[model samples]
Structure formats: structure tokens, C-alpha cells
Target: MPSSASAPSRARSARPGYRAVLRAPHAGRTFGAALLGRLSYGVVPLALLLAVRDATGSYSAAGAAMALFGLASVLLSPVRAALVDRHGPRRALPPMAVLYSALLLAVAAATARPGTAPAALAALVVAAGACTPPLGPVMRTLWRRLLPDPDLLRRAYSLDGVAEELLFVSGPLLVGLLLPLVGPAGAVVAGAALLLTGALLLVASPLAAPHPRGGDREERQAGADGAAGGGRGRRAGRLGGGRALRSAVLAAAVTGLALGALDLMVVAFAEQQGRPEAVGWVLAALSVGSAVGGLGLGALDRPLPNAVRLPLFTAGLGVALAAAGLAPNLLLLGAAVALAGLFVSPALTTSYLVADEAVAPDARTRAGAWVNTAVNAGSATGGATVGLLVGHLPLPLCFALAAAPALAAVPALRTRDFGGARSRRKSDPAPDPAP
Candidate 1:
């Protein structure tokens, strides 16, 4: 008698453990694509600036284009994320990806043309960034879908944060490595290719498939049972109008400010020491520490709720960064930066979890988008401030300025009212029990 062919073989071939999440059906393709997509973003700003500078012979023009790119991405993120929440990836990703990649080509072409109009280059930069696949927000939503168990879900978020740091660390390195061999235009061309490839792979993932508008069966059932899903009026005031998300986004914003300060301090230190080449390794050390801390946090069985832990994490990060500025020499400064890096991703991860908790299931993608925008905005602001201050202030004082926002956020985070939406549902009349 012929038996069903694939079931026994599939069961026998299954993998296990935390890494097994990647081995889950289509997980590798989805995760890899998201990772590469983020990495390309990392490469673009620096590479595009150099490319534009080479063609135009104007650092100011290059800076203007890069700034426009950032502005567009931050401003447009929520709108794109809302589309993802409403239409899902199949309906969303391909078109945005194609448009974004095509604009990158335009930007690349503009950068290669010696006499291209400055305003034209600026327009291309902004338009390209406006539709960057909404990849980060969509990936966060997918983690929730793939991991039903609460513990596993938290772990997945931690891992996701770690992945983000890897993109930061690797993106610049790729550009640096390729620039010497390929020239600025060629490096940009490579980045555009990577973005398109990752976008296609992401769209092909099984998780990219659409879910019903509200969510799956259990979500609907929860709503029917007077959960926050059904008690929309009660949840309306808190998570209802999206006030709770502000705290989470603020926390992320401050973290970004601190990170940007650290970045400038590292560069200044390297320049002072006459070892500009060493800048890469110093930054790499910081990234490694973040990855290590995030991995340890993600693998743990026990976890702290975001509200209880977020303030403490932010405070710890602030203290460490302040102390880093006081280090006696370059060697000690690198050590201090690496030590401070330990708290970076954990704080962001906690904030993300907090943000996710405050929003309804249907609103999470857009919520994530808002938080991400706050992060980039703060970073850009801080970096610009550093550029102005690095020549005027003492180096240690500059670092202290970065640390202040994070420390200030500690009190802000504690006072912010989150989880009110869920708690509000407790007083509602009980629905009939499920059969």
C-alpha cells in the first residue's frame, strides 16, 4: 500500500532550538532578505554622499542630498507602514520595492552624471527613500505571527534588535571595502542591487502572505469575548487614540541621540590620534558588544516587562556613556564604548516591546513605523548638533550632552501611562465561555 510521502520525511528533518526559528519554513529567506534590506540602507547614505561629491565636487551638495534622503524616509515611514497593516506584503512590498529600487538607480545615474542638476539629485534621493519597503515594521509583525508563545516572541524581538545592529556595523564596512575597488558609482550600483535582491526575497517568503483584516481566529474570538479588541470604547482613550505610543517612541529617540553622540566622539578621537583608519575597528567593537548583550537577553527564559525594566535600562545606558567620555586615553575610551554598547540594543528592544503592547494588533505596523521614525530623527538631530559642537566644546563635554537625553528619558518613561488599554478591559462584562 502506498503511504503519504512527505509527512514522515519532513518530521524527521525538522530542526530545534532558538536558531530553529530561522529554520522554520521560509524563515531563512524572509530573515535574510530583511537583513540585507536593512544593510543596503546602511550603505546608501555614506555611499551616496561620496558618489554625489565625486561627480559634483561639492561636499555641500552631497550633504544636502543625503539629508533629503533621511528626511523623506522618516516622514514617509508611517504612511507606508499603514499600507502594510491594511493590505499586507503581497499587496504592498513589490510595488514599493520596485519604486524604491528604481529611484536608487536614478540617484545613482544622477550621481554619475557630472552636470546633473543639484535639485534633481535631491528630488531623486528623497523619492527613493520614501518607499524603502517598510521592511523593519513588517518584519516585526511577522515575528509575532511566527512565534505564538509569549517567551519565544520576546526572544524573537531581541534577536531582531541584534540583527539591526549587525546591519549598522556591516553596511558601512561593505561600502568602504567596495569603494576602493569599484569607485563611488559602482559602490552605489552594488547597494541598489542588494536592495532589489532583498526585496524580492522578502516578497517571496511565506510569512509575506496576507492575513484577514483584523487578524486570525483567536484574535476575532478575543474581540468577541470583550477583550480590548471588542471594548474599543474603553481602550479608546489610552491606546485608543495612540497616546501610549509616545513614551515608547520617546525612549527610542533618546537612545538614538546617545548613539549618535557616541559615533561622533569615536570619529573625533580617531582624528585626534592620527589614526583615522582605526575608526572602523573602534565602531566594530561597539557593535560586537551590543550583539552579545542582545543575544544573551534573547536566549533567556525569564524576562522583565518593558515598563518595569525600561527606565532602569535607559538610566544604565546613560551612566555608561557619560563615563565613557571620562576615559583617560584612546585605548580606555574604546573599552568604555564597548562596555556602554551593552545596554544599547536591550533598551531599544524593551522600548519596542512596550510600543507593541500599547497598540492594537491591527495598528502595530504603523506604530512600529512611528517609533522607527523617532529613532532616525533623534539620531540625525544629534549628529548635526555634534558637527556644530565638536570644534567648540571639550570632547568629554560633548559626550556628556549625548548622555543627558537618555538620563532624562528615564523619568519620562516611568511617568508615561502605557498598558492602560489592556487594563481598561478588565471591568467589562464577561462574555459567554467558549464550548
Candidate 2:
């Protein structure tokens, strides 16, 4: 912890950068450990897909297993986050990590030999998915505990978002490296090991210690209510009490949907140009643009309030997506996609900020998880929607259609309920003494 004398000087610094975010006591260790664990999320999907396919010898079976795994993980995210919120990370995370790791090892074992039953793989994958630790949400909550200044928190979240994006990108590469040595089954084992180590390190961080103001107070209150006649009112009020949370979730969902559609749209565009292999390069541009945009957001000392910024960023992404459809060539499409990417990270970072601030401390993890759920669910829906429409509709029209949800979300986000000044007043507590 900083000396009392140093706190004032720290506060007076104009704009906290990513460097400052890292410099927070225990911040770097805590965040790095979280990232290490999150890398498993990046690695496991492709690794599992390949492992299953190799074992089952059927693309359809592999697809089904992957779908089951993803669906279970995405759908249960909020439940896992709620566990962390109610029980605290130290109590909640380890058991989840252990269970998930064990399941992954089971998967690896099953895939070690050929002709593993598709039914067995699907069941194992679903169980593993359901047990997947909510490390991302928990880490974001830790950031809140570590950095109370909204500016520093903004920087922290932006950094987190960008790092996560890179992790997902690099995860596949790591599997590629491991493939010759370990094969896909071995890659699955590596993911499990990474997850277990990261989760253990993360929980051990001093920064991840249970907040005095978080779960305990809520649990006590709930017990008191149970003792009296007021039953489950707190549960009812859990994630639905505020307009800011709702808008943040809605915007995140739409933005995710648009981006998901863009992925397929880009492929379609590349194929139409008779250069299918160019898809990776175009997507790389998108990732780079998002990284730059996220860093730019973190650099801002003073920025528009989340209420205004969320809608603005979302709309910018929508407009860019719509414009991308008009590009007749791959170069132009890539450029447009990059432009759209500029809004992606900023929008997501702001949505997380909104979600964090909109809820009570104990509820923050679940709030953030809701945003995560929205994004994943939206992305899935968008990809499926575009898949159905791609051959049936003109490519340009499909692009415009992909952009529509984000455009429509803008006005809903701008309502008085998400009023910038009012929401900030409600959400921004005085900087909690740096833990």
C-alpha cells in the first residue's frame, strides 16, 4: 500500500497510463496470473476441436462437441460469476479451476486413443465447460478493488481487453507449436495445466483477497432477511436494478453481433475476390486496429462519460460495418474492417466499466459476466444469422444487415436512464484506499 502522504501525489497525476495501472501494488502479478489462466480459454477451443475430431474421425462429431462445450461455458458464465460474487474469489475460484482442469485431463485421456465415443466426448466437454472458472470477471473485479480512480480503472480495463484479444489470437499459435511435440491431445493437457497454475497464482495474489466491503456484508444481510419475512428480495434485485447495466449489456450484445457477422462477411468478401487465403491478413488488420484503439482509449485522461461514449462507439462501429459492404475489393474491405475495429475494444471496455459501476461491489462480478454472456450469445447468433443469409442475400446487403443491431442499440443507450452525470454520481464511490 502507498504511504498516506504518497496517495495525494498519486491522485494528482493527470492521466494514469497502462504503466501506472501495472504499477499499482500487486496489480501486475494479479493481472499476469489472470492472463495466464485466460490463455486457456484461448487455447482450449481449437485444441479440443482438433482433439475430438482426431479421436472421433468425424467433423460433425467434433462440431457437436465444440458447440456443446461453448454453449455450456457461455450459458453458465453468469452462474459461475455469481458464485464468485457471493463466496469471494479465494473461496470460489480454486474449486472451479480444479474441477475444470480435471475434466480437461479426462478429455485428453479420452482423445489419446482413436475412436473415442462422440457421446462420451460431448458429455465430458459440457461438464468441463460448465465448470470453466469465471477468471475474467473475477480479474476485472480485482481491478476495481485495485484501482478506484475511474481513469485508472479505464486504463486497466482497456489494457485487459487488448491483452485478452491478443491471448485469443496467440492461443491458436501456441497449439500450432505444440502440435508436432504433443499433438492436439497434448495441447489440451497444456491448456489444463495453464489454467490450473494461473488460477492458483491469481487467488494467491494479495490483490485478490476478499474485499471487506464485498461479499460478507451481502451474505449477512441476506441471512437477516431470511430470519425475518423478506424472502429473496435481494436475489430479485441482483442484476436488474439499473438502467445503466441494461444499456451496457444491450450495447455489448449488438456490438458483438455486428463483429461476429463481420467475420463471415470478410470470408465471403475474400472468397468473392477469388483470394480466400487473404482472410487471415484482413482479420489481422482488424485485431491490430482494435489494439490501437484500446490503447488510445487508455491514454485519454479525460473522456466522455460512459453513457455517451458507449453509444457513440457502438454507432461508429455500426457505420463502419455498413460502409465496409461498399468496398468492391479486398484491400478496401480490409481497410473498412480496420476502421470498424477501432470502435470494438473501446466499446467493450466502456461496457465493462458501465457494468462495474452500475452494481454493488458484491454484484460486480455477475454484472461483468452478464456483459460477457451478452457478447458471446450475440456473436453466436450473428454468425448463424449471417451463415443463413450469405448465399441467399447480396454480400453488400448482408453487411448492412449485420450492422443493423448496433445502429439500433445507439438510441436505446442514449436514454435519460443512462444519463451520464446521474449514473456517475450513483456509481463512482470515492477511491477506495488502494488495497
Candidate 3:
């Protein structure tokens, strides 16, 4: 077998494509299982929301419970990711999956019948959210291992992002399917089952196996360097210490803010046009545009360096959103939103790529998780901010305001290094793995 140091060279020489990534040994099984488990992230929220509403008989109570759940999940993600980095996925993932699954099952049982106490339900959901496994970050980190070639890794990230977008879309549909047969609580049960089964199968994949001691020369050297005291000060200190990661996190947060605000703004636009029902189609257009953009990015053989691409994507989103605000009619608004969507996945995928390249292998999970948290936190903040602004400001102005963060992020993201010393320059023939 080739050594870890030589793997990137071999991968670089191979043709890069979505198919090639899938064909990488163990990639298909690992990715498939991760997606299966990740689907629960999509499924559980709607299921739990419905169940909570049914149990409490008050939308306000249900919304409050979900808010606590989402806050706990988003805020504590890095902690969970740190644990994975500390213990290794094989050792850590299963327990989290088990606990998270059990909690969801408990939530289902409690919500199966009406009159469940809101406080008790809130506690259960909060615990469940805190236990939500960091599968997305783990899977992305594994992708780096599975595909050492930077091009392939880029495609993998794009594919992963697109798959995730589709998963969230399909999740609600899946719940809808189950509702006729099983109802809301049963949908929650089904989500729990999916999470447990997928997580177990993910760990069972060969790719999830720990790297043998001494197999990774770079990590070994990094470990040695860290142990040597003063050397640690010179290395990227922590998740946020590096410039590249900061840029990624900033871009991610801004883009997320734009998206979160856009969601509410779109609904408001539809309502203003006397076509509230058009909201779904407009949002679906955004998703479809994102999927297309992601697939287009994955198909590239020699795409622009992440540093160069990141700013452009963010700017594109900002300009598109600004245009969306000017649309005179609902159809035009949908078109403009779809245009904005085109940048969503590419920007996020590039951010992940930049973050992965910014840190050492040991810190990969935490690095990715930080970016994940920034996006979610920014989204939550944006929604709340826009909710207040929409009632007071013109809807068009609100849309333009939503575009501000993404536009502002462009300059910050324009820096030369998106992966610290590992990032490829614009003139480089292709990206190479860090030495």
C-alpha cells in the first residue's frame, strides 16, 4: 500500500470527478451512511415541531421549545466536535448517536399523546439537541482522508453540500409521507431509527477506522513539534487563530445571515403580492439554483483557488439579493432569489475547503464545526433581526439590508490565503495537499 505522504500525489494524478470521488475505496459506503444519519437533522426538526405543537396545543410553546433545542444544538456543536477530535470518531460517535437517538425516541413517546407538559418536553428536546452528533463535520473531515487530492476534495465538498441541501428538502417530504400512515410522533420515531442505524453503519465503514500509529508522517511531525514547546506558538494556534479560517468563518456567517433574512423576506414578498402560496415555489427555486451551482462546481477540473472563489461567490450572492429586492413582480423576485441561490453552496463548500486546509488533521473536525456554528448562529441572528426590521422598514429595503452582510464579507474574504500556507495561489496549476 502507498504511504499517507504519497497518497495526495497519486490522487492529484487521477482524473477528478464526482464519480471518481464516489469510486475512491470506501468513499461510497461512508458518504452514503453519513448522509443517512444526517437526514435526521432535516427530519427531526419538523417532526418535533409538529409533535410539540400537537402536545402543547400552542404554537408559541412549540416555537419556544424548538428555539431552545436549536440554540443548544448550534451553540454546543464545537464542544461535540472537539470530543470527536480528542477521542477519535470510532470511539466517540456511537455513544452520541445512541444518546441522541434515545432522546428522540423519548420525545416521540412523550408527544404521542396530547397534554404533555411543555417544561418536560422542553427539557427532553434540549437534551436531544445537545446530544446531536457532529456527523456533518466528521463526514467532511473523512472526505479529506478519503480523497487526498485537492480537486477531488473540492468536488466531494460540493457534492456533500448539494446532497445535504437535497436531504433537508426531502426530509420534510418524507415526514409528509409518514404522516398519513403514522402521524407526527411516528415520524419522530422514524427519524430516531434513521439516526441510530445510519450512525452505526457509518462507524462500521472501513474509512472510519483510526489511522495506524506512525502511518501519518505529517501528523506525527506536528505532534512532535507541538510537544517541543515554543514550536506550538508558531503553528496555527487554535480554530480561529489562522487568517484563512477567520475568512472562511466570516464569509460563512455573512452568507448565512443573507439566507436567513431572505427566507422571511421571501415570505413577506409573497404576502405583499397577494400570493402567499407562491412562497414555496420561490424558495424551491432558490434550492434548485443552489443544487445546480453545487453540481457545476463539483464538475470543474481546475477551478479557481478557494481564496479567489470565496469573495466572488459572496459578492454574487449580495448582488443577486440586491436585485431580488428590486424585482417588480413575484416571478421576477423568484428569479432573482434563484440567482442568489446559485452562490450559496459554492460559497459554503469553498469555506469548508478553506477551513480544512487551514488547520492540522487533528483539528479538522473542530475547524469545520466552527464554520458550521458561525453559519447557524448567523442565520438565527439574521432571522430575528429581519423579523424586527420587516415590520418597520420597506420590504425592498429589508431585502437590500439583508444583502449588506454578504457584500461586506467580500472584501474581508478577498485576502490571499484561504488555507494559510497550504492554500494554492491563483497561478498554481492545481491545489496540492499541505506538506
Candidate 4:
């Protein structure tokens, strides 16, 4: 039995192998999980829409079913996060995946019944949404666990951001491809199956396992010492409950507003010159730019403070949106949209990272879910506002208006001591433990 000091040295001797795994093996799992998660999100929405439309023979009904699905996800996300926090990802993910898959199949089955199709579709959508496996938040927590180096963590998040962008861009495309083959009903069934496979794979991955007790205990001790050391730790711990909820709400509102405006602008711009196809190209350009930025960030060697990075990114996004709105031609507008989108993914990734650092471990999943909900809400608000303004105001004005939330985030970027600094020494490679 070596002394405690000798034990760390001995542990250090074993680290080269672990580092190799962290650099490649762990990253592969994280990326795989992200890809599968995105694939499911990408496929499921279209499948649902197609199924609902087929069953009810109305696009409106399909849209309503989709809305219900969104509502289910928004309402249940926190609950899923809470489950992950309490029981760990492994325990929570598999069952939810199974349930979601079953509900998707139920929707497929209901579509065959003319009388019960509409109600069944709605119910199934809600059920599927409620049980939807939250791969992003869970995988993020896993990333923190498996890759403890700060630079690596940043890269991991950057990769995750890129995967997300790809998902938005590719999910619909995959759904489109599958729809013709599976005939809407088969597509929905396939999506459910795919989701089930991915979720189970994610749950079983070694990276997704619960943290070892020794690590957890060490973190608690460090937190206690840090809390005793200064006001920062005190404030960090205090940012729970209402304050955390408020911040999350504000962030979500801003996200919803910005996204909605962007969606409206895209449609309006495409319709401006009667080139309906331009909308797809413009959206693709935006996603491409975001993916490019995420890739760039993933390859970076240095990390910027979130307090600094987030505000800068937000401001950049606003400028890009304004430019996109003011562009004279479709090409120019597409370029601006792409540039604006570049900042969006990175900015969002940074915000979530900050929220992860700021909130307590117990509340982390809920915090993340709240952020997601805020984004959706902001997107809805933006769409509504842009729709109203497109007819009344100039297109440039609408773009500027859409940029408001990102602009607003600038003022809110004031640095508060979120106790992350204590455990997160500049010398240390990973994020502050768990919290």
C-alpha cells in the first residue's frame, strides 16, 4: 500500500492510456450519441406530421398534433432532466426511450382508424413528447464526466454544437427520404425503431455510466472548502431555485423571440421575389455557417470566459441578422443569414455551459430544459412578431426587430460570481465538478 501522495503519482502513471481514451474513445461516444439524438429529432417531426396529415386529411390537424408534441416536450423536459439528475442517465434513458417508441407506434396504429385517428394522434404525440429521451442534456453531463480537461470539454461541446446544427439540417432531409419509401406510416414506425435503438445504445455506453463515488465525494469536499474560502462560492450555491428559474426564463424568452423572427424573415425574403425555393437554400446556408463556427471552435486550443464569449457572440448575431435583413439580393441575404447563424450555435452552447456552471447539480437538467423551452418560446414570439411586422414595417426593420433579444442579452452579461472559479482553477483541465 503506497502513501496517498504516491497513489496519485501511481494514478498519474496510468493517465496516458486514459487520456488516449478521453481524446478519442470518449469523444466518439459523445459524438455518436449526439448524432443519433439529432437523427431521431430530425426524423420524428416529419413522420409525425405525415402520419397526422394522412390520418386526419388536414394539414391543420397535423400542425396541431405537432404543437401538442412540442408542448409535451417542453412540459416533460424538466421532468426528464430531474430523473437524470437523481438516478443518472443509464437508469432514466432506456425506459423513456421505450415509452416514446411505443407512443410513436401507437400514433401509427391510430392513423389506420378513421374515427379515432385525430384524438389518438394528439394523445400519442403528447405521450411521445412526454417520454422523449433527452439525449443532449444527458450526454452533456456525461461529457463532463468522461472528459475532465477544459480544452477537451470545450471541443466536446463544440462538436455537440456542430452535431446539433447537422441534425436540424439533415433530420428533415432524412425524413423526406424515408417518407417516400415507408409511406408515412412506415416512416413513423421506422423513426420509433430508430429512436429506440439510439437511446438504448446511448444508455449502455460506458461514458454514460454514473460517476464513481470517490469522485463525487472529492467534489463535495472541494465545494465545502471553496464555500468557506470566499463570497463567490456562497453566491454560486445561492443561484438555485427562483434566481436560476428567472435567468432560464429570460434566456428562453430571448431565444424564442430571435428564432421566430428568423423563421419569418426567411419566409418573407423567399416570397419577396417569388422564389419560394430560396427559403430552403437560405436555411441551409444558416445551418452551414453555424456548423462551420462549431467546427472552428472545436479545433481551438484556448478557451474564452463564457461571460465574455457569450455577450460578444450575441452582439455578433444581432449584427448578422440586421445585415441579412438589409441585404439587397437573395445571395447577399443568404450570406448574411449564414453569418448570423454561425454565432447562434456557439452562443447557445456557451449559454448552456454557463447555466451548467451556475446551477446546482440537482437542478441542472431542469435548468437545461428551461433553456430549451425558452428557445422554443422565443422562436414562436419571433415568428408572430415578424409576421405582423412584415406587412407593416420594412423588411430591414423586421430584421432589426428580430435582433432585439440578442441585443438585450448584452446588458444581461454582467459577471456574477457563480462559484465555478473555485473548483475550476485555470490550471485544471476540466469543468468544476458536477455542478
Candidate 5:
């Protein structure tokens, strides 16, 4: 790591050339990849909802299929990351992309047939879940490798977070618009096509090239040596000895649950007022707020210490979300949603950064995958539990309940302070100044 003293000098020296490089065609490819990835995410949820609803003629079944997909993705995330680490992204990305596209086509085909619909939809969900190339993770790893400056890297990740929020807002809207013209099956196919095109561009971009450090190669060779020597148990033990990986996985799970609850709360609150459309507006307000926060954070030259910032922001977010449930008017609820959203992108960005700093360089991709998987898993869990509660209880009660996960996260904020030398030094404090 560069010293604090040299950081500004390095930034001044690199800024002009970095800007020029970022303006090149390859950078456009990076943006394209990001755009497509977000678009695919946006399209998939709506398309799945529509296709499953059309095929099985049940909203519950559709939701179940979506949940299963999330579960499968969570389970497969590590495996996908392992592949990216072992073979390099170039070799790993294409097959996953192809499989993802093919699965969508299969789903489209299944929707056309009445008798075979259920099994096919289930199969498609599983395949889609398994085959989702660790695009977000891979892309993030590439960005880190390509941009060496810590601040620049933070900015990139923050921008990506913003882009992700934009995608969430716009993707579904796009699907809604396209549904009339192309039908649900066609929208699904379009999403697949986008995924394929985006994945290819991402893999081909200059930033996406493999950058295995000397230590990474050594670790790989050692693993191979151990395997060839029939030291399977040793190899397994070494791989499983990743404390950072465990931390990332836990964080992901927490994030997933929190997002899921947030989703349920929004819908439940909207329905409670007999103005279901308010749900969309509230969610949109949240998304817009998150996007604004991310962009503003990214543009900043200085950032608050993650240790201090994360807990404060997250706790504030929890309080805001809780307030939204208690809000009696639409205007107040909208404000609450916006307040809750203000911390979202920042919180997620901090998590990603922490995960990045925690893991070994080569393992970063996998670590990121773990985070994404956890997010999906959490969202699914939140959706199911909150959905069920809303069905049986008062909507505000369900909304209030949704804040539990975020509230639960307050204690975990200390986890962010770990492995930091400054934190350690502060705690140790020179034997309390010799008493």
C-alpha cells in the first residue's frame, strides 16, 4: 500500500493519464458490461414473474420459483468463484454466459407448452441460478486490478453501486414497457441476449485480463502439488482455512435478509393504505435516494473511516426504515423510505470494500461472488417471511418487523473494525501511557 504522504502526489501524477485511459473504447466496453448486467437483473425478476405467472397460473408458484433460483444461486456462488480463480475469468465466463442464455430460451419454450410448464420452469430457474456467471464479482475484481489507487478503486465501486441501483429502478420498467410489444417470453429472451452480449464484452475488455500475482501462482502450484501427492485432506483444510471468506459469507447473509425485509415492508405498507401504487413510488424513492448517495459518495475526495461510518449509517438506516412502518401519511412514508435509502449504497459499498480488503488478492472474485450470493439469499428469505406475515397480519406490523434485520446488524458493525492496524494501535495504546 502507498503511504498517506505519497497518496496525493500519486493521485496528481496519475489523474490525467487515468482519465484519458478511462475515456477509451475499452472503458466503454466496461460501461456496457455494467449496463447490461444491471439491465439483465432488472429484466430477469419481471420476466420471471410474468413467465411463471403465465405458465403456472399462480403468483405463489412464481414467487416460489424465484426464491428457488435465489437459493440455488447462493449455493452455487462459491463454486463459480472457484472456477474463476482456478481457470481465469476468460475461460470461465463464456460457458456460464452461454448456459444462462440457453436456460432463458428453455424457459421461453416451456412457457409455450401447457403440460410441461411447471417442470420446465423449475428446471429453468435452477439452470439460470447456477449459470449466472459471477459477472459482478469478476468485474469488480478486474476494476481493482486495473485501478491501483485506493481512492479511485473506492470511487469505481461506488459508481458501480450507483449503476446497480439505477438498473434496479430502470430494468423492471424496461420489462414492463417491452412486455406489450414482445410478450413475457420475448422479454425473457431479450434478457438472455443481453446477458450473453454483456458477458462477452466484459470478458473481452482490457480491464478483465487475468492478473495472477506471484503469490497466487505459488498457492495454485502448492494446491496442485498437494493434490498430485494425494494430500486431499490437507488441500481441503487449507482451502477451508479462509476466515475472510467466512466473514464475507456471513455479511452477505445479513445483507440478503435486510434487503428482503425492506422489499416486503414497501409492498405491505403500500397495500395497507389501499393504494398499492404507493409501493412503486416508495421503492422508487428509495432507489433514487440510494443512487444519489452513491454518486455523491463517489465524487468525494475524502471518505469517513469505514469503522466509524458504517455503523452510524447502518443504524440510521434501520431507524429510518422502522419509522417508515410507523408513518401514517404517504408523504411521511416517502420521506422515510428516502431516508432509509440514503444509507443503502454506502453500506453496501463499505461491505464490498471490507470484503475486498479482507480476502487474498486472487480470492477477491470469489469473495465478491459470496457477497452477491448472500445478498440474494437474504432478499429471498426476507421476501418469503415478510410476504407471509403481510398476508396474515396488519401491514404496518410486517413493515415494522422488516426493520429487525437492519437493527440486528448494529452489533456486527464492530466486525468492520477488525484487521485494521489503526484500530489495533488505538486499542493497545502504549500500555496506557505508562500509567
Candidate 6:
């Protein structure tokens, strides 16, 4: 064994801190591919909404389609994630990508047809959404596999949050650039192409490929089946995370509901003013704020404990949204939305981190899927809500719908149930004064 003199140095190096985490194996390659695939997430909803609006001439119809899309996506995410965890990305991602792209093209074809019924369009959107590649959860889950160290994992999540913010901004900007030239249907086609390409790259990355299957495959698959098995499941094995997982999922659901409304209102704000193309720029402003927040959080040596911060960020989101409701011009609206968005990615990152902490390693993907599920479910609520409220009421008041749920999320975070984390960080007790 090394002498005590060298012990400190060995311990420090063994930390495998944030930089080392990035350099770990296939981390960068896998993440970059997933980032490209995720850009389509920003494009598809808006593209579909615009396409439906162009075809059906009804914002209500467009909203219904979006709600259906989120609903389908939310329902299917967990199942898809479980498949990834058990079988790995190579087997899972490619088939989902293919089916998802096909369905998107089907939706585009229907949009091209002049007289497709509104209900039919909505069904098509749902079908397309159901096929969305489970790449997001798969990628997020990769962090846990790649970095077992707590601090490094936290930093990776923060960086992932920043990347997601960038994806949102760039994805929409891309759509805006193409809108004038290609029209809405063409935008959908473009988004599908990116998603397909990204999915392929993501699977090809060695990081996402299945590890050597010893006996772990059966164990992970078993976890998938028992995750929701109630009280008895909790006692069984690592399969069930019990109350903490539920609480985290609950928080994610509430957060997602609030965001979904904000998305709808932002879109409506531009469309109502006869400058629909400006939606991308306004959203980009919001995402810029989010990126800044995420990066700042990530760069900190010892970031604020996510448990304490998650609720605060979510509440801040409510405040920003409330301010946004009063914005009278595009500039003011962009600023207001950006302010709220500052809290968005941070909250999401915290949720992902919390999910990882709350669940067993085998179920990390499914846990991530639960977070995605909440977001999509909330998106459905917000989209459908704003869709109905768009013409029937003053647009500003509709923002309250988004704010109320967010403020409500504040209470959900009060649960002191998440296990395996200390409520307070250990004090350094006066960092041994330098001699």
C-alpha cells in the first residue's frame, strides 16, 4: 500500500471528476448523436401544428393534434425505455426510428391532402408520436452507466440540460428558416430526416451499444416488470424504488403541465400577431436564458443541492410566466419567456438527476422515461388547453392556466421522501487552516 503522504493524491485522482467523466469511454460520441436526434423534438410539434393549420385552417384542430401527439408519446415512453434498458439501443432505436419516420411521413401526406378530416389528422399525429424513438431516455440513462461518481454524474446532467436548451433553440430556428421556403409540410419532412439520421448515428455510437450480456440482462428485464408492482415489489429487490420514484415522477408531471401551456401561448402570441415565423426567434430567446442557467449550474464546483433547488426553480418559472402574460409586444414577450425559461432546463436537469438517484441502476431508463412521460402528458394538457382558449378568451389570461399548475408543483416538492441523499450537505468544518 502507498504511504499516507501519497494517499491524498491518489484519492483526488481517483475522483474521476467532471472532465474525466466526459472523456470516459464513448460519452462524447453518444451524447453528440443524441443531441442531433433531439433537435427534431423542437421541430415536429410546431411543424405539425403549422401543417395542420395550413391544411385544416383551424388552430383548434392543430392544438388537438398536438395534444394527441404528446399523449401518445407519454404513454409509450416508459415501455420503449424498458426495452432499451433490457435489449440496448442498437436493437431498440433503429426500429423505433424507422417506424416513427414512416408515421411522420404519413402525417405529412395527410397534411398534403386537402380534405383529410380533422379527426383523421389528429389520429395520424397520435400514431406518429407513439413511434417517437426512445433515444432521449436512452441517452440520459447513459450518464449513469458512464459515470458512477456522484459529482461527475451531476455535472454531466447539467451539461445535458444545457445541450437540450440548445436543441430547442436551434431546432425551432431551423424550422423558421425553412417555413417561408418549404411551407409547413416541408418542415415536417425536414424534421423527420434529421431525426432519422440522428437516430442511426446514436445507435452506431459504441457508447449506446449493448454491453456484454452476462447474467445482467435477465435481472434488468425483471426490474422492468416489477417497477410498478406496488408494496410487495418494494421489498423484492432493486426493481422498485418505492416512494421516491413516485414523488419525482409526480414533480415531473406538474412541471411538464406548466411548460406545455407556455409552449402553446408562445406559439399563439406570434400567430395572433400575424408573424408566425417569429415563433422560432422568440423561443430561441427563452432557450438562450435556459442554456445560460444550465451552463452556470454545471460549471459550479459544488452545485446547489438539487433537492432544495428543484422547487425553487419551478416556482421561479411560474413567476416568469406570469410576467410573460402581461407582455404587450414581441420584444417584451420574448424577454419574459426567456426569463421563465431560465428556470426550465435547470428544473428538468434536477428531475433527471433525482430520477437517477431515486431508482435502481437497472431501471434508470424507465425512470427517465417517467420524467419524459410527465413532460409529454403536461404538453398534451397545455396544448389542448391553449388550443381551446385561443379564440374564446383574451390570450393573456390563458397564461394563468400555465402558471397555476407550476405554482402547484411547489407543494409536490415538499415531499421529504427521496431516499439515498442527505437532506443537507456536510459542512467542511472550517477547511483546516493553512499552516
> Which candidate leads the pack in lDDT?
2
Worst 10 residues of 2 by lDDT: 223-232
Clashing pairs in 1: 236-240
Per-candidate TM equals 0.87, 0.91, 0.91, 0.85, 0.83, 0.77
Model 6 lDDT, residue 164, Cα:
75
Off by over 4 Å in 2: 1-14, 212-215, 218-237, 417-435
Q: Which runs of model 5 end up more than 4 angstroms from their true locations?
A: 1-25, 212-252, 391-397, 419-435
Alpha-carbon lDDT, every model: 0.76, 0.87, 0.86, 0.70, 0.70, 0.76
lDDT by residue (tens digit), candidate 1, 1-435: 235687777665552346766766677778888888778888887888998888788999998888888888898998998787667777788889889888888878777768788888888888887877778888887886777555666677888899888887678889999998987777778888887788788878888876556444334233234435445543311223244577778888988888877888889978887888877778777888788878777776565656666787788888988898898777888888888878888878777766766655556677788888888888888888888999799888988888999898877788545544352243222357699
Error of 4 at 402 (Å): 1.0
Candidate 3: residue 15 Cα off by (Å): 3.4
Per-residue C-alpha lDDT of model 2 across residues 1-435, encoded as one tens digit per residue: 558978888776745678889999999899999999999999999999999999999999999999899899999999999898778888999999999999999999999999889999999999999999998899998998888777888999999999999999999999999999999999999999999999999999987776466546754343334323222244422654267889889988998898789899999999989999999999998999999999999998788878789999999999999999999899999899999999999999999988887665567789999999999999989999999999999999999999999998888889654524444444334334597
Candidate 4, 115-200: lDDT as tens digits: 55577679878888888888777777667666666666677767776777687667778878877677777778878887788788
- How displaced is residue 385 in candidate 1, in Å? 1.7
Error of model 5, residue 252, in angstroms: 4.2
List runs of model 6 lying over 4 Å from the truth. 1-21, 52-63, 109-123, 179-183, 213-215, 218-239, 263-283, 320-336, 383-401, 415-435
Clashing pairs in 6: none
lDDT of prediction 3: 0.86
Task: Tell me the TM-score of model 1.
Answer: 0.87
**Candidate 4 stretches greater than 4 Å from native:** 1-25, 113-117, 214-253, 416-435
Can you write out model 6's per-residue Cα lDDT over 275-307, one digit (the tens) per residue? 888887887787788888776666666666666
